[model samples]
Target chain A: MTKKKIEKQLSLPFRNAFQMSLRSLKIRFGRSIIVTMSILLGIAFLMSVFSSNAFTNALIEKGPEALRATMQQNSQELRTRSIWLVSLSLLVCVVGIVNAMLMSVTERSREIGTMKCLGALDRFVMELFLLESLAHGLLGSIAGAIIGIFAITIVFLLQHGRLAISVFPAGALLKYSLVSIILGTTLAVIGALYPAYVSARMEPAEAMRREV
Target chain B: MPKEAIVRTIGLKKTYMLGKIPLPVLKGIDLEILKGEYISIMGPSGSGKTTLFNMIGGLDKPTEGKVYIDEVDVAQLDAYELAWLRCRKIGYIFQTFNLIPVMTALENIMLPMIFAGLSTDEAMEKARQLLVTVGLGERIHHKPFELSGGQQQRVAIARALANDPAIILADEPTGNLDLRTGKEIIQLLKQMNREKKVSVITATHDLKMLDVSDRVVWVRDGLIERVEDRANLDIKIGEVEGEEAG
Candidate 1:
């Protein structure tokens, strides 16, 4: 009898992983929304800080000297405080993401076992999780950027009246929004990494044996 | 004529770490299952029947010895190859009817085929046919939560048969179902075994399964206590209560 070499298994198309992740996100919409909210809040704070800094700069460069002098006096202290707040909020956001993802992995241990039994590779499992987090991050970040810009704009208009519109920092705000979006996406994926690895490394038998 | 062996285990052993100590689950099991055979492994809980099933299905590694499926040594395969063997060669059914809850019955069945790289249209067509075969033609659109226990098991059966695997490893496929449903599932499995000529191996406590199994292997204390041909032993449903009480 001759030994037969097992043919290499085909990797699942990215489209399948994308669709599967999308379907799961839709099914667990409430949980997805809660996770997304964490990203939203953190990115919102970051974006607001960015927009405010840009606004102050525009006011310093373009506003009346009297208003500019006061702005300059307070901008340094405000920037320092906002930086600390943004860093703290982002840390909280990452913790929230990691907690939610870990819970999700634990909750789906049986499903993961079933998928493995059905021949899903560890890579496929990881891909599904990462893609799901990516979607949440993208959605949350985009919404947060919009909300942040609107909020800062409202506050500035109230504080500085018509002068605020004249130096709204629209161009800088747009650039900052893009940066916030990318940061949010990267943070979400990084936060999900440990959870995804945990799920992927699970032995099928152990996972199935788990009561959860 | 002797049937070809589809699965063979030689000195298969598995030990689990119970904290500081190693507890042996399978104390060197040696067994052979023929192609197209319907075999039932019966044992009380903690008797190592599930461990044996997992070893045969390549879901767990053995601490010693080898398992050959269609003459391929399971332990010798790398992770990718093991996955391929699982994807295209072996199917699994669980006691709890572990269908992907988020997917409809059709999609649940289609998943394995998708993993096997089947085109979406082809997988869908075959999945529909398998659902019909499992007597779930009308429940294809329902999610597992929407279906009854028996219906969910039927979907799982269809899903297990998705890739035309050479063997179906079912760990107490009917464990969670009522007697009538259990009997129905046994009948369905036997029918599939006959029609598809796919080997069916089940670890079960359901006595109804013995009626259809060609051979019954009784396990005790992490070893095969006896292997009885169906014709050699008479089984009564009442014996289940007696066995449980013991």
Candidate 2:
């Protein structure tokens, strides 16, 4: 019934994972706060960057028929512009991933020590960090995706429906959102590992001596 | 005597490698402690009391010899087994009363139980009983930083007892307390020893403590120089400090 032996007796990795995460979150509330702030900042940046992307998309989609009247003069230039804008959105998301991961790691030093001392294995410690990063990434990217979709709609109305970009690729948008979220979390786990290891390998006496 | 020897250390040593050459801290030392005994290990700073305490508590291992707790060689245990041993059989209380500052007194008491996987209802019941035993039943909701030093120590005492460990190893438990609070903590330890039949081992430089201990062991330069009963505690020969040897 003691806390240390519960995992061995219960076979409850899922419950333990959550308990570890909550314990980590409790100990590193300040770090959690900072991680949340970074996530919000990254998502906000994604939204702003992609809002303009939606506008460009709308511009490219519209006026295609009009340009068809003079196809040789217009088609190639518009195609190049569309590729350039899509690349810009992709670049923003990559930057966002890197930014979020670094901030999350910097805030969670003592927490890793606490977990390791409590009998967490090497892989368990890694998974806790990974889980935290995944949670932030999932929440952030979903919010970003929904905002990007809404931003496209807003951009379409703002331009008075003149842009011809397909307004509704709901399935592609949903699938891409899920992919980016997973990718963002994977990047966060990588960024979090070095810090978590530095924190985990701390000598127990040293950690016990630490005031915090 | 064999069954009573809950902790035994033989020729234990530890050396810190400062830049290449090892700086020895604990020299070859041998000592045995019995179950349910109230003993105090006393010495001045740099006498390696903390190092020895950490070693016996399974938080660290000696480089040279062996340490056994309850017939199980701690030095032979792997990381997971060592942790389990520490969490289940040995309870440690520190000088700073290292209860998590964010947690309430009751929460700190229950953490070991929760970690050990007791059901919420059972853990709470045990925690409440311990807090009452430590005389902290009313302050259960107060966070560590919010409580006085004595109160915080009480919470730590409760935490140490939460899992019902056999040996309560305290390293300078009252180091940070004032005289009044410190003496009160000593009294609490004595009561726990008598009533709960829990073995208590404390390391302190406070000479006032040797008066109260059933066995007073003097440690100097990483080795035990003497083991004395309360009557023999009056002798001055080979004691840690000439000034404090009563």
Best by lDDT: 1
Estimate, for each residue in B1-246, the C-alpha lDDT of model 2 and write its tens digit: 354787888889988777999878789878888888889998877888999988888766678888888777876666666656656676778887777655678877776676566776887899988988988888888888889999999888888877778898899988999988998899998888888788899999877677668888778887787788877876643373567444
* Clash count for each candidate, listed in order shown: 0, 10
Q: For model 2, report the TM-score of its A chain.
A: 0.65
Look at candidate 2 and give me any clashing residue pairs: A2-B116, A3-B115, A3-B116, A3-B117, A4-B115, A4-B116, A61-A164, A61-A165, A62-A163, A62-A164
DockQ of each: 0.65, 0.22
Model 1 CAPRI quality: medium
For every model in order, the fraction of real contacts preserved is 0.66, 0.16
Tens-digit per-residue lDDT, A23-50, candidate 2: 6566667766666555545554445444
Q: RMSD in angstroms, all models?
A: 2.3, 5.2
lDDT of 1 by residue, A1-212 (tens): 34568777556788878888899899888988888887888788888888887888899989999998998899899789878877786676667656665676677878888888999988888888889888988998899889888899999999999999998888999999999899888878776766667665777887777765
